[model samples]
Target: MSNLIDMCNCCNGCSSRRQGYTLKLSFPKKLLVATSVLVILAMVVMPSEARALQHKIRHERRQHDAVALTKDARIRQEELRRRPHRRPALLPQTKDPAERLRNLEAERFKNATRTIQKKLKNTRRYFNEERKVLNETREYRDGMPAWLPTINFVAIHFHTYKKQGATLSERKFAYVIPKLHKSLKEFLEIFDRLYKVEVDFADDPFSNYNRTRHELIWNTTRRLYSTIAEIEENMAAVNVPEQNFTPSKSLQALEMKVDAPQCLKNDYIAFRAYGNLLNNWFSEFKCPHGKKVTTKNAKCAAYEAKLIEKKNKRNKNTER
Candidate 1:
């Protein structure tokens, strides 16, 4: 048993020595070897001692820039062009109507002034004649002659022009429905609070009226009026009457065709206000009542209704 134990101890000592030789003794050298290997690898990568590299013969080449990736660094073709000019993509959009209105007014005034100046130059005689003719027509129409009621006749005539039915004359209520609803919602809130006497403010519509100015009314006619006005003013400065105006019918009308979405907003407000205005106007007149005897043209509708009434009576008589 002692001999076996001695042999085991010897084997254990030999194993420990082998482990030390393989692991601990070689550890420092191994570390040194690894470091040297890393240094050699690093040297190979940079190759500072190696010869300078010749120009690489690439198959194809194209110039590129990291800056070209930015939005403005790009050229806008017809496909990419959205508006009048190139602008930063990240800008917050602005849609202030007041700002737009001011710009519109300036443009409109310049345009109208240019037009009047042009008319003053070109067709002075004709403009004078037309103004006189309009005045005479107004005078003639104002008098209720023994012959006819002019205003009613003219209104009827104008109304008769709608062969397309009432569709064209009917300003679409649906278009301004959103605004109407908004106003109605507001009105309901006001009504509920009116009895409580909580708020000091009272609603006043007339305070918002713009003075009857041609420029203010016409300003929203088109884009960047000052740009056009600048051109017009320059032409006028050079005594170029012909250059003062364009030949387009649209240009003559001084139309302020608002954007559909924008028009919806404006017309919605217009509809509400105009509805009130019309009511007030009509109420003040204290007229447009009493048709005891039917008038000339619409008497046909009444006659037809009367005939239907008589026919119903005759049928009842016969049945009885």
Candidate 2:
């Protein structure tokens, strides 16, 4: 009976140990299963979290881009505000090239008229200064040989030849130059005669010799006056091309004919003043017909070509 009881006790002890071991193993298995489940949840939740982070970063980038675009637009607006306002052109834009050209021509003509007026003012000022210089040097005695410079200076300066394709101003200048040349020639002759009487017989008493000299001077002055009057009349409508008009025969005839009274050789300031006075008249004469014009077709093709070249150069510079 005692042996049997001891054996049963041993068996119970073994069974208890086995139960303890199984409980420990079962705890480990449950722990492993819980760990595995947590790993699976982490795998699924981390992807969603990463996607949310990526969405937030993309939204931030878009916002930054929007801000940058707004800042750039504001800067452009400020820059434009700081810039000067451009003035509108006098002429309105036209689709027709001919009409546009006509408008441009009209504007140019208006501007040219103002330029001509300014030139006239400058001419008068210069001539007035010359008159003062001549007056200061007017201390010559009677019978002095007057030193009258020829009017070739006027001829050289004013003469213009026929150019095949010339501007309106150029053509007008050419048309007027011939008449000016003729007038200058006549003026030189008149000046020579006047200088003879005014300088040579300044101190002479009333006598036949002086009277003859005075008469000759008076007649010459009258002729010069007539010539100036004619020029002034012609200038009223100055576009008339004098193709058929002939210069006076007397001018050509008297090219070498000089039978003036003997006089002492001296600088004559009065003659210079007289010549300049006549020049002032010529300077003031405005040509009513020197109107500016725009070409209807490719007449001013040269001007257009130059404009295109200028634009091309500008574009190349911008590229660089």
Candidate 3:
């Protein structure tokens, strides 16, 4: 046993030196290693009750946060309610029936004329400005990066236009068609809404003025119905070709893997392309069945011009 304890000679007499060199740590290093070991041990051996208590505390904090957020939202909503929005003046405030009637007539002409002119302007712009941009965009479409945000934006524009077209079709079918029917009840309601005129004892339906206006509305309603019917028939008959331009799939996948700055740059490219495409599509479409189906006609135009002249005269008289 004594020989075994002193067997350094058999092991080349270096065993003692090796033991001394084995993982010698300084005081601070020893403290750091001990702390790390204790931390790991604590994490591994923590009690379930302690963990449940911690979870309960965190859940209570989240509930408190949610309650605070809801309260803040209610306060903000109440503040908003205190401030009412102002509406635009739709008609002149008058006591005399004759003056009110005259003003209503003037307003009818003005509103109708304005509506017609706006429609015409929008139509013209689509053809000139919108068409130009779309044709130009085709030049860049093939050259654009496949993985670019522009591709997605173009896709979005295509889908948006389709959705808008569908919505317009629904609106026409659901609301415009029913409202445009010229029954006596609907006629009165529509006229009241549009002209801000109330029908009272003084206004006889059989009187020349009332009779003429009623006939005009009826004629206009019939024309609108015919136009809408024609549009539906034409749409059913004509099949639009599929859009030629679209983004490549490979680029769209690459976009998912990229960082923020690259993503933003791609997004801008897509948005610009989409905007141009929308304008182009809208421009090419001719108002179905031409000007006859449109609001602008000889009688309405003349009446509109006459109303404008009368308005100018009244303003001048007030100035004098």
Candidate 4:
């Protein structure tokens, strides 16, 4: 277009510079240069072209974002729509609620086992962590023998190694715990009955129990066991072993009773394996030598003084 401008069309200061005339044209050299630059810029800057480029950029951006968002949304929606899997055919579903729960739990366990097997030796850390939580939080005990802090805590601390043939399988937990719970139930019934009896005969009828908070806590392990059993039976869908503190011929295979104190001990009870605390409690205090004061024939006053001195010294050393 510039090349087409002829020498005749080129304007002198007053050479036909009027609007529509070929003669008398007049423009300053500076103004003419500016006008020429404006013409070149106008040719380069078509408004419709710039507008189309911006619109195209915006459209492409929207498409890219929509693809990413659609992918993420699809993944989430798929997750929500996923169904829980059923168990294998070998493990039949029982009509009982407890058995049904057990079946579902077995499936869950199988899935976990499969996943863990896939992880191979890589899941040792996770396994160890879970073991710690289970042992710590799931510990149970009865009063006196099992409830003595030192013995029971040590017993719990005794970890069952692979060589010991103890595993964290459900069968192991279910198998061993019910026996432990019998003594627990007996203790609980005794304590609850004791508390009820004592509360009625308090020093003041309206007064709170004379027991210390720690004492109450110490005694409450039995109650906790009872409550846990009830909760398992009702809420956790766990089948609680039949409550048996008295001997029944049918469940005799499960009952292990009274190595000592046949009169005081519950009959149909199978207590916890001789855990450290329980063993120590029975050994130290339940012996024939560990006699209570006899109303008819008492120990010597000198023996009492010596025992009191020993007890005080032990207490002092323990505090330190």
lDDT of 2 by residue, 70-106 (tens): 9989998877776533332457889999878767655
By lDDT: ranked, best first? 2, 3, 4, 1
Clashing pairs in 2: 143-200, 144-264, 145-264, 145-265
Taking the candidates one at a time, how many backbone clashes does each contain?
0, 4, 3, 9
Candidate 2 deviates by what RMSD? 23.7
TM-score each candidate: 0.15, 0.26, 0.18, 0.28
As for lDDT, the candidate ahead, 1 or 3, is: 3
Q: Residue 50's C-alpha lDDT in candidate 2?
A: 100
lDDT of 4 by residue, 1-320 (tens): 24334434655532333444443344567989999999988878877689899999999999999999899888987766663443334557578997776677655444443332233222222323322321121123333333211213222222243433322434433433444345445444443432332222334412322333224423354334544454234323434345445532333322232222221232112122222223322222212122453122243333344445766776799899
Q: Write the per-residue lDDT of candidate 1 for residues 174-267, one digit (tens) a residue.
A: 1121222232233223222222222123233211221211122232112113333443454444333421221323222222443333322332
Among these predictions, the greatest TM-score belongs to 4
Model 1 reaches what TM-score against the true structure? 0.15
Candidate 3 residues lying further than 4 Å off, grouped into runs, are 1-143, 147-254, 286-320
**What's the lDDT for all of these models?**
0.33, 0.47, 0.41, 0.40
TM-score of 3: 0.18
Per-residue lDDT, model 3, residue 81, is: 68
Residue 73 local lDDT, model 4: 88
